[model samples]
Target chain A: MAIRKEKFTMIKVAAQNNIKADKIDEFIAIAKNLVAETRKYDAGCVRYELLQDVKNPQLLTMLEEWDDQEALNNHLLSQHFKDAMATFAGYLEKPGEINLYKTLA
Target chain B: MAIRKEKFTMIKVAAQNNIKADKIDEFIAIAKNLVAETRKYDAGCVRYELLQDVKNPQLLTMLEEWDDQEALNNHLLSQHFKDAMATFAGYLEKPGEINLYKTLA
Candidate 1:
């Protein structure tokens, strides 16, 4: 394995969403598309993946790792993200909880 | 980057904890040691990271990725894991919320 020489700080995001029981499938479909687009086109995206809780299928979390704050801010303002948010408005049980974190280890 | 040839299913775990405000630093100290030990000694441990919430300092999450169920189960049963849990008992505001997930994209 090869390691990159430059040092960079990563911005980790965990966006937790709880969907209505009946709208879980619809939520996943929209989420999967959003993940695909984010990973394909978003610059400085290291990891952008959707995860469904095994015990509670209605619970979803977008686990994201970006190179820095600039990358994360750009992603939030992107068209696909806005579109996904609009589509998700009706399916959410409540507003999503987004948390930003700095890795400690 | 060198991609491995073998195919394996990963078990993603998000273990969220809310520490007592005064115990946050102590909790992080214990957690950092656990993360280091898990990464250095545990087999099939792909990622063992401790993340502190940027907005809420008392909120911490352990983001883990294991190779499969057996690996996850093994980690849960390990002495280091058991020891960490015992040490964390008094520092926590409440029980940790553990969620297992599979990547969707």
Candidate 2:
């Protein structure tokens, strides 16, 4: 790779959700609904996706893009998020990990 | 999240790069060049992003989308990938992790 100059501007949310073995299907069902709702209702969300690990299907991850920090904050505080969290109760193997990022390029 | 039905079809690649603390800047510089080149040359690449962790700047993740498995496979086999990997030598703190996924919704 040749060293070149360019700038990338984007805010991303990377999160992991580990579901119980038996509840994998159920978790996916609920998550699909959540993704659709988020895409429809949140204009700030450029993209929201749920992905399943190829090696371990039970391990899932969400990759999201927002216009900015404020937009992401608003979405997290929205009723949809609250309600989504409610439905997720007892479904996760643990709290899981979520992180934010800004593109370098 | 209300339970609703929706289908999402996309191929995503999630990868991590843990750069040596001293080489982080160099890594980003090389990465930015690679990203621009990939975006310019690849038609099947819908989106290719590089992100830095908010809490730990040394931890970086790449999120990429391709039209299908064939497109992604082509990218993996491309000269650009080979060149990029070459530039990455000795810069990593660890081997890093890369995984493929199919969106659930």
Candidate 3:
């Protein structure tokens, strides 16, 4: 097989839940919208997805890939990112967690 | 409450497996080594972890955090990363995947 350069990189984020399970849809939508704007509209982002932890629906995880850290850095500084960050932070009842990794397996 | 600045950022990585089910230990160790060196030895990294998929033992996931994209970028260029990459790339039976995200929820 011909070798090709890897186009994207991964990161994971988890939020500490305070939003009632019944209202998670409301919360999830806001987060989902934020991501779509970042990944779909943002130039550097390659792919992004939101994954709910099956063991704990309250736990929300985001899976995303970017061209590289630079592409990611650019996304963070974009105007859309600033708008999303302003309101999104208020939805979290507790501070969230994020993890970063390079594919090595 | 005073707001504390968020320190680390998140990223995720996944690997497609070709290693036999029983041989995962050996393969995992190698993957683990790459992560440890990338996170602990690299000054910019905040935390790192390797997570296994419950449904598929053959699947592996990596969870990591960095001070930010800059720290992550620094880690990527550090000598340990280069060393790890040189050998790590050969072990993978198939290409690995990575994701990047900003904690918004």
Candidate 4:
């Protein structure tokens, strides 16, 4: 079998969200909606998933995979993202920690 | 088109590693070796990618996808993991932050 080489870089962003215990259910609902909307409307999105922590259910993570930086940039400016952020502001205990990463292999 | 539903739970673990500036190259080499070995040997590993931070080059993230918790547990006990951890001890500025996540959708 021949080795397949990936020419284009794929970007991954993991955002950690710590929500209040009381707002867990509400947060999940909103997040699910946001995921659905993003996957449906955002053409650049390869994978958009909302993950909940096993130890602390209140802790949530958003794992996103995009085609490139341009795609991710477009997502940042999209109306859906803006709307999601506006609604998420109240449920967050502190600012979410978002980090960007690129795959080496 | 019919929507495809994933029956089995796929577990994801994101580990944040902050390496000393001097050890970045060495760390990446070791991490690459580990990833290659894991992919070759481990049966349960679905995806294993080493990601670099765009803003902070010293910050590294390991995004892992496994079939289940049991598979993840086995990996934790694998020789490759132990060897990698032992080698990683000297390069890290701080303890790595490893968090487990479950996808909701």
Chain B only, TM-score of each candidate: 0.91, 0.86, 0.67, 0.91
Clash-forming residue pairs, model 2? A83-B1, A84-B1
For residue A50, model 2's alpha carbon misses the true position, in angstroms, by 1.9
| Model 1: CAPRI class | medium
Model 1: per-residue lDDT, tens digit, A33-63?
A: 9999999999999999999888888889999
What's the lDDT of the predicted structure labeled candidate 2? 0.84
* Tens digits of lDDT, candidate 4, A1-105: 998986788889999999988998998998899899899988789999999988989889999999998899998899988988898889998787999888876
lDDT of 3 by residue, B1-105 (tens): 999987655543222344456657776787687776775577656666666543455656656666667777787788866775676555655666454544543
lDDT of 3 at B36: 67
Best by DockQ: 1
Correct interface contacts retained, every candidate: 1.00, 0.94, 0.00, 0.90
Task: Determine the C-alpha RMSD for candidate 4 after optimal superposition of all C-alphas.
Answer: 5.3
Docking quality band of candidate 2, CAPRI definitions = medium
| TM-score versus the correct structure, for each prediction | 0.90, 0.83, 0.45, 0.91
lDDT of 2 by residue, B1-105 (tens): 899765445688888888899998888888888789889987689989888998899898787988877788788788987788887878888888887888777
Select the stronger candidate by DockQ from 1 and 3.
1
- Per-residue CA lDDT of model 4 for B1-105, tens digit only, reads 998986787899999999999999999999999999999998799999899999999898889999998889999999999999999999999887999988887
Greater TM-score among 1 and 4 belongs to: 4
| Candidate maximizing lDDT | 1
- List the lowest-lDDT window of 10 residues for candidate 1 chain A: A1-10
